[model samples]
Target: MSPQRLRDDLVKQTKIDVLTADQAKDNEAHMHTVSRSFLTDTITVPTPEMMSYAALSSLGDAVYHEAATDALEKHMARLTGKEAALFLPSGTMSNQIAIRTHLTQPPHSIVCDARTHIHKYEAGGAAFHSQAAVIPIHPANGHHITLEEIIHNADLTSDIHFALTKLIVLENTLNGTIFPQDEILRIAKFAKENDLKLHLDGARIWHVAAELAIPLEELVSPFDSVSICFSKGLGAPIGTCLMGPAAFINKARWLRKLFGGGMRQTGFLSASAAYAVSNNFEKLFHVHELTRRIEKGLIELGAEILSPAETCMVFYDPAPLGLEYAEILERAAKLPDPITLGGSRLVCHIQTSDQAVADFLALISQLKEEKKAEGWVPPEKTHVNGNGVIRDVYVRPKAIH
Candidate 1:
């Protein structure tokens, strides 16, 4: 289907005036000024088609327990191509449960990228919930940690006073980097030889599948356990699934309840996930294309686009224009129409499009070209290179530290 046709269908299905208010409010809390019409997500709601699935989204209290577990088990089993899957309200819960289940012994350590979501974004949930110490390895560039690094670190593993290596957690499409199947196979072999349980944080696995032209199951097959998120790029309202051994998920269900992640009649939410799995998968490809277009545009404009446009994220450190982070974010939030970004986090989802891409490019051009006086160099702007003499030029400005 054409993107325009799908958007029209979504319009009939979604209620633009009402469905998007909540999102705007949510965005407002974070300093965003947006109208409902600008959103691309169908779940942004008031859409009639999305409402048709109310039967699926509305689960009774007892059903929340049964359906949540059922959804988790069903999807996860398919994900790892494994025995079971468990549902949790948040990825943090699923990850914590995975860690706790793997670390049956005390003082066990989890090896993961230093920028792993579990380490960088999930607060100290691993420490507070699992009580396990993290062994972090930074990716040489972006979030793509090398398989050789995993092996070197794991082979040098020890049972000394320090925590014993218990689990190897990898975020596929690390921070913003995506790994190929060959890399997964290599790391999985190393993980197996050393007897460490491997976990794949497939938060953006769906995005990777679209980008790499690989099946989700094939992409995640090497890991012993896999955690998948429906909310990120999949555009589900909320939910994450943890797939592993049936026995492991059996324990996970209880852990989810303990963490207050259990919901009643969760098939309502899972139904959206089901819709995403069935109908929404293709849109991710559009997101990938749009991201490439935007990143390329940025580069063409002389901004240093970060590498690994592997999935949905496009990270750039715009120098010279290195203004205050707060000011940069503030500008992003207030952009009039067909634009947004307020959080300093630039990401693309299924709803993002070429129009949005063009809008963002135009705004960036404006931001980059604005100068205090004539020419490109603004007196306030400054950058220092290897040479002692710092030169000023017109370029994308990244926030200074």
Candidate 2:
């Protein structure tokens, strides 16, 4: 084909508009929906003010160290009291990269809390990316893991019979329960004496600081490396920063490229994250308060609080009221102003409205009344599935029609 004809064809195929004619109205509706959602904080959308500010960011390529990206990294490094920081697309990448960078040799293992995102939700990235074995340990107290548990489970031998434990990972606000800082210090001391590296999956570490009024530097000081996300409770559109010593982050920056996480023109994304830290950090306190309200409401309606709102999430069991999560999910969606839920986890975010909390409690109260009218009784024993695992009752929404 002639050059002119090829150019014309490419233009014709690429020139298409994604926006609807009523884009403004649609966006307004979406904002309203997000305000009422208790599904997860990751669903929270960026505000127009944040987007407007992002538009003016430097248009530099991130692989070559973009200006805004560099600034954000520096700010995060200072904020977390680390020597340096590197930005990645998601918290998972930040975490996996940290793991890959820390474990240079094979036949190694990482000791972590049983309910950590690294082990449960990262799709086996530690094993896949670094070829490292994971030792997941449950805490006896049922909240945060203790130093004794780490000492008991960690493989510290060099008998060539077991994978040597080189790293210890912990999560802040795992299931919305803050990992006690005092315990973290104790573990940190153990890690130091044993020459083991300590890392933190601090995606919601902002919540710990917000709830307890602790400084970020002090909160993360115990860990050798820490990954903090801006998208979850802080409501940034995208990006997470992995902070550590200058050498560790420098190596992680290279691995970030090898993992195909390097981006071009990341100035806008960095600016959005910076805005989240500046504008949305204080808002997390309100999110935690809202979460506590949901916990209190569920308790008043006779639901069992499996996990209280230590931060921005609460896990409750409605079995005490003879209600299943599936029924509650269906009923809440059918309300005049619908509220969204995800199984037992109710995560309140910066955009969550007071009215949403009130509506959620109202729905639970109504469901309790309906169950009473139908002569439903709470089971003497907890509901168990065929596999003998107690059911939490997560259900996908059926067709509306």
Candidate 3:
């Protein structure tokens, strides 16, 4: 084939217009949906102002330590009072990289809460990347793991049969409940004495600071490394910063490349995260307030508050109203202006509208009345174990006709 013909074919394949005529309209509708979504904070979209600011960022290869990316890393390090930070594409990557960086050999394990993202949601990245076993301890207090639990469960022994606990991981605002700072300090002290590295999956740690009125540095100071996310609750499009000692981050940067996460021209992405750090952190107060409003409304309408609005999330059971999650979900999706829900976990974000919260409460009120009229009886109230049932309900889209 002729060079010109080959070139023409390639150009034709690449020259496709991704945008449809109604793309703007669709995006507006999407924004409206996100404003009402009670699913997860990760669904929050980037704002025009944020994108515009990001567009003006320096266009440099991040593999070479791009100026914007480097600035973001340094800023995160300063905020968390760490020596350095590494910007990665997701919280999972940051976490797995941290684990891989912390552990050096086989016959090792990392201890963490049973419900932590690292243990349950990271697709076993620790075992895959670090060849480490995860010791998931169910917190006896039903709130946060205590130092006693760690001491009891952690395999600190050099027994040939078991992997020695080399690292301890903690998640602040696990299921929207903040880990007690006092407990964390005790655990940190224990970890230090035992020569175990402590890491934090601080994906929603911003919520902890905003709700508790704590400084970021003080909140993260106990851990050797903390992975703070920009995407969840902070409203950035994508990115998580892994903060730790300078030497540790340098090694993490190399592992990031080995993990195929090293990206080029990441200035725009870093700038967006910087914007979130600067502007959106304060907005979490409003998010928390909105979450509290939902909890309050649910309690008033006779819904069981499974988890209180300690931060930007609340888990509730509709059984008290003689209703099921499916009933509310069906009614919510049918709203004139539809509100999205993911079952028990109602996560409020920077984009979550006050009206959305109101509308959700109104839906519950309406459904409660309907059930009462239909002679539906509330079931016998039993203590629902916080860790027993999976909280979040997954919804699939119906055919649009």
What TM-score would each prediction reach against the true structure? 0.79, 0.94, 0.94
**Most accurate candidate by lDDT:** 2
The per-residue C-alpha lDDT of model 1 at residue 239 equals 75
How does model 1 fare in lDDT? 0.68
After superposing candidate 1, which stretches have Cα over 4 Å from the reference? 1-47, 56-72, 141-143, 155-159, 320-328, 342-344, 378-401
Writing each residue's lDDT as its tens digit, candidate 3 over 1-401 gives: 99999999999988878898998788888999999999899999988899999999999999985999999998899999999999999999999999999999898999999888999888999999999999999987888889999999999887899999999999997999999999899999999999999999999999999888899999999999999999998999999999999999999999999999999999999999999989999999898899999999999998877778999888888876777788788889999999988778888999999999999999999999999999987655344456675333423232111
What is the model-wide C-alpha lDDT for candidate 3? 0.90
* Model 2 spans > 4 angstroms off: 1-7, 380-401
lDDT of 1 by residue, 9-96 (tens): 9999876464555865665433222221223232332223443664556354632455534654576587558888876777777788
lDDT of each: 0.68, 0.92, 0.90
Q: What is the lDDT of residue 265 in candidate 2?
A: 98
What is the lDDT, from 0 to 100, of the residue 141 in candidate 1?
52
- Give the total clashing residue pairs for model 2: 0
